[model samples]
Structure formats: structure tokens, C-alpha cells
Target: MSLLQTAPTCDPDDQWCVWVSELTGNDWLAQAADWLIAKPLALLVLLIIAFVARWLLHRMIDRVTNRAAEGLPTPMLKHKPGKDVPATVLSGRRVQRAQTMGSLLKSIASIVVFTITGITALAQLGFAVGPLIASAGIVGIALGFGAQSLVTDFLSGIFMIVEDQYGVGDAVDLGEAVGTVEAVGLRVTRLRDVEGTVWYVRNGEIIRVGNQSQNWARTVVDVPVSHEQDLFRVQSVLKDVAHEVWEDEDFRSVILEEPEVWGVQDMTPDWITVRVTLKTAPLEQWGVAREMRERIKARFDHLGIELARPARVLIHRDNRAAGEDLETTGAPDGSGTPASS
Candidate 1:
């Protein structure tokens, strides 16, 4: 009975000693493991908070910017002679400028957010960012010399913005390339051609610019009437057409000034050139001119006027068979045919 009792007590003491040893060896590791599990959850929560904060900040900034621009008078909102202003849409240039500014602001905001998140993530992982920043500076300096063109482009873009050389939706001709300015940015200018192709021109390379969509555009139309038609009659017809076009539904909105007819600009044996000049709103002159041409055709056709083309009434005579009566003319040599001069 004494031996059994002694054995049980010794066994219980040994078990207790083993449990203490295990705790002493694995305590720090257990705590570290628990922290590792919780770290990911904490990071996820932080990222969610950051995302929500960024969205709210963007909305606030956008609202503030829009509110500041509310008092400005847009072209679309202005009262014109024969135009109606719709309150929903802003003017072309104003809308374009707004979009460009918004893009720039969003880009800057995203850069800021990304930078903060990256730094926070690195710091949370127990990394020293001071050395990283120092290395980044050295590398940036080293790359600066090779990236002079990029620097020039950026600087030129900023100057362009300050100077307001041109803006989106403006019809500009840059050297040999002519197109509508679709977007203007710090590094490059985007252009869209009539063919719907987009061109990217570097800002630094633009030395000459032709802006066609400025205040006004001129529509010059040349109408050719038959030489047989009376000069006064043709001029009278054009003047009437111009007056009617000024009151036209489609053209009344675009024509700022009535078209003035310059009579008999040039004369030929078969045709007389009549010139019509008009002052039209920017980018509206083409449609106005096209409409005038259609009206002119209708007017000429109604008045029984014959418009001639550039073709010579050629006299074809077989010199070898000159004595033979030219089939069309009774006279064998009646100047064979009156060749159109």
C-alpha cells in the first residue's frame, strides 16, 4: 500500500513539470502567431476605411469645384439673336475645360492616396522608409538628365495652361496637321480629325498654331450663272435667296450677319461668277454655306438658268477627209464645229 501511493504522487509531479516546460518554451511564439493572424484583418479594415475616405473626399472636392463655377455665364446660357438657351447643357469650351480639370484633380488625388497607402503599408510591416526615400531621390536625380524631354514637355504644358493657347473642341491647325482639339494635357495635345482619327502631338513641339474656331468664321460662296443670264437678274436672285436664308429655320440660328452679294466677280464667255459673303458663328459657316448652295441651285433651276461646266465644244474634223461634208454641219468647212473656247 505504501509503494502504490508513492508512485501516484511522483507521476503527478512529473506531469506538472512537463506542462511548465512547454509553456516557457512556446510562449513568445504563440503570441507572435496570434498577432500574425490578426494583422491581416487589421490591414483589411484599414484599407476599407481608406477607400471610403478617398471616395468621400473626391465627392466633396467635385462638389466644391462645381459650385464655384455655377455663377459663370456659359455660351449656351447666353441669349443670342435667334437662339434659345437650354439650361441643361453648358457651353462647349466650358464643359471641356471642366472635364480636363476634373481629370487632373482625380489623377492627383489618386497619386496622393496611393502614396499614403504604400508608406503606411511599409511602416506597418516594420520597414524603414527613410533609406528607401533616400535611394529613390538618388535614382530620380540620375534619371533626370536622361528625361529632359519629358521635363520640357511637362513645363511647356503648364505654360500652355497659364497662357490659354487653346482648349478642347477648338479648331486648330498645328503646323501641317489640322484638326479639332479634343484634349489638351501637360505632355501632349490630342486632336480628332474629320476622319475620326486621333492624333497625339507633344506640347513642346508646337511652334505655330492656327485657331479657326475663334470669334467668327466667313462663308464665301461662288455661284456661276449662264453668261446669257442678265447680271442684274442673277444678282437679284442671289439677294432674294440670301434674305430668305437669313430667315431659314436651320440657318437663322447660325448666321450672325446677313449675306451680302458681290455681283459679277468674274466673267467668261459661257459663265459669270457671283460671290456671296456671310459672317457666321464659329464652326457654323460650313453648314450655312452648304445650305446657301442648295438654295442657289433651286433658285437657278426655277428661273431656267443653265449652269455650265468646264468643257470645250470640240470640233473633230478628219483632215484626211476634209473635202467630205462634215456629217453634223452642212458646210464642208464651216469652222467644222464651234469649239468651246
Candidate 2:
């Protein structure tokens, strides 16, 4: 103030001094200086808040996962011989589903928290956020219209996880592909089919899911025998095979109940099919069916029980000789005797 009072007024012709006087008298410069000094500190605080919120969000998700897991039954399976089976634990599918859900929650929380933090930080820097928020809303609405399929996929994925429709390691038949689920994400599910081809299926496109590894499964073994074989004998043999498989120590745990022999399911001209049904643990039906088939085949072979085989017919014709005889015998007259060559 003292220097300002002692200084002489600048001449209108002196451009440099006039410019300096205007710059020093401007109030906006000081405001800008204060803003510059405070912006970084505000931004740092916002970053800290975002990180803390992220940590809290993850912790909450972990707690929820643990509580959900607690309500589930401990999964157990027969271990290989001579190997120690671990204590009871959650099923592979359950654990994977929990983990996937936790990751999705964390990701969504981070997105929302960071977005809000960014908007707040922008407002602190003296930027108008109302227009930005309005613009974002309009853009979101436009995107919703343009990306309906994307929204459907995300919603379907969310419901799929929440309802526990299918999870990793579960075998499912999605109208287009039948395979084991390898990964389930927000947009798509990855499956590996029997041929080992990995398939990426959009969640919205899966209208129906046939989960084969849930609860229990039925092992159906169809044994076809020749029509010549007695139906009663075949039924008896199949019953014996089923009983043996059920009683076997190696497969005992997989078999939930005694196997049933549904006698004479179908009869064709050449064969009669007998059905053997076994109730087995989830995912064990295939192995049980295969083992039952092998055992039945061996038993049939040992007992000389004939399986249905394709019938072949042979036809013999002497067209050339018959034509020659007809030509020699025809002479515009009826003749009962054969013509001499």
C-alpha cells in the first residue's frame, strides 16, 4: 500500500506500465492463485476417500461371502486311494460363485465411488457440475436405448449369480452349447464342451439352462440284446449287473440307492432294450453309466449272451442266362420245352 501510494500514475502512452497496472489491480489473479494452492490438496483428499471406500466395500463383500458360505453344506468326495482326503469344504461351484459375486460387487463399488469422487473434486475446483451431470444423464439414456442387449446381458448375469443358476465346474446345457461352465462374468459365460472347444456365450442369449451337476443325477444304461435272447434272462442279468455295481466298494459312495432294472423299455424287430437306472451323486452319473456299461458288456460276453447285430441279406441272380434262354425260346410261337444251344 505504501509503495502504491508513492508510485506515479502511468501514462496512457506507456503500454508496458499500463499493462502492469491492470494486471496488479485484477482480483481474478489472486483467486486463481488460491485455487491452484488448494486444488491439489482437495484432489488428494478425494483420492484418499475413494481408496478408503474401496477397502471398506471389499471388506463388506468378504463378510457377506463368508456368511453365505456358512449356510451351505460342506462338499465331500471320495479321494484317490492312499491319499488323505481333506476336511469338509464348500463345493467348487459354490466357492467359485461366491468369489465371482465378490469381484463383481467390488468392481461396481469402485466404479460408483470413483465416479462420485471425481464429480465432487471437479465441483471443488469451481467447475459447474450440473450441466455435466445433465449431459451424463442424457448420454446414459441414449446408451440405454442403443445398448439394450448389453443391459439385458448385465441384468441376466446379475440374476444368474444371485439365484445360483449355474456356476463354475457345473455342467449345463444352454440351448446352443452343452458343457462345463469355466467362468461366469458380467457379460458372458465361458464353457468348455466335451470336445474341449471353449465357448463364450452371452448371458442374455441363455434362455434356458439345464444344470446336470445339481443335487443328484440318474444313470441310465440301456442294454440292447438280440430278439432271440429271452427277455426274462436279459432282465435278470442286468439286475445282477446293477446290483454288483451298487455293492462295489469303489462305487458304493457314488451310488445313492440300489439300482433299478426297468425291464424291456423298448422292443424292435431285431433287438429288445432293457433299461438300468441308478441314482448317483451329482456329476457321477456319467462315470457310473460308463462303468455299468463296461461291466454289463463283460458279463454278457462271459455268459455268451448275444447282443443285437445288424442283419445282412445276399441275393443271387443270373440275368444274362435268363435273357439268352428267353431270346432262344421265343420264335413267334408258344413253347413249353427249353431251347437247345
Runs with alpha carbons beyond 4 Å of true place in candidate 1: 1-49, 64-90, 155-170, 181-186, 190-198, 214-216, 221-240, 257-277, 294-341
For each candidate in the order shown, give its overall lDDT on alpha carbons: 0.69, 0.77
Tens-place lDDT per residue, model 1, 5-103, is: 333221233333334335654434433543465446556776887788779878865764464345354432222322332222224544455555556
Per residue, candidate 2 scores C-alpha lDDT tens digits across 20-76 of: 557786334434444555467778999998999989988987777664554443222
Candidate 1 achieves a global lDDT of 0.69
Cα misplacement distance, residue 270 of candidate 1 (Å): 15
Judged by whole-model lDDT over C-alpha atoms, candidate 2 comes out at 0.77
Best by lDDT: 2
* TM-score of every candidate relative to the true structure: 0.59, 0.74
Error of 1 at 3 (Å): 38
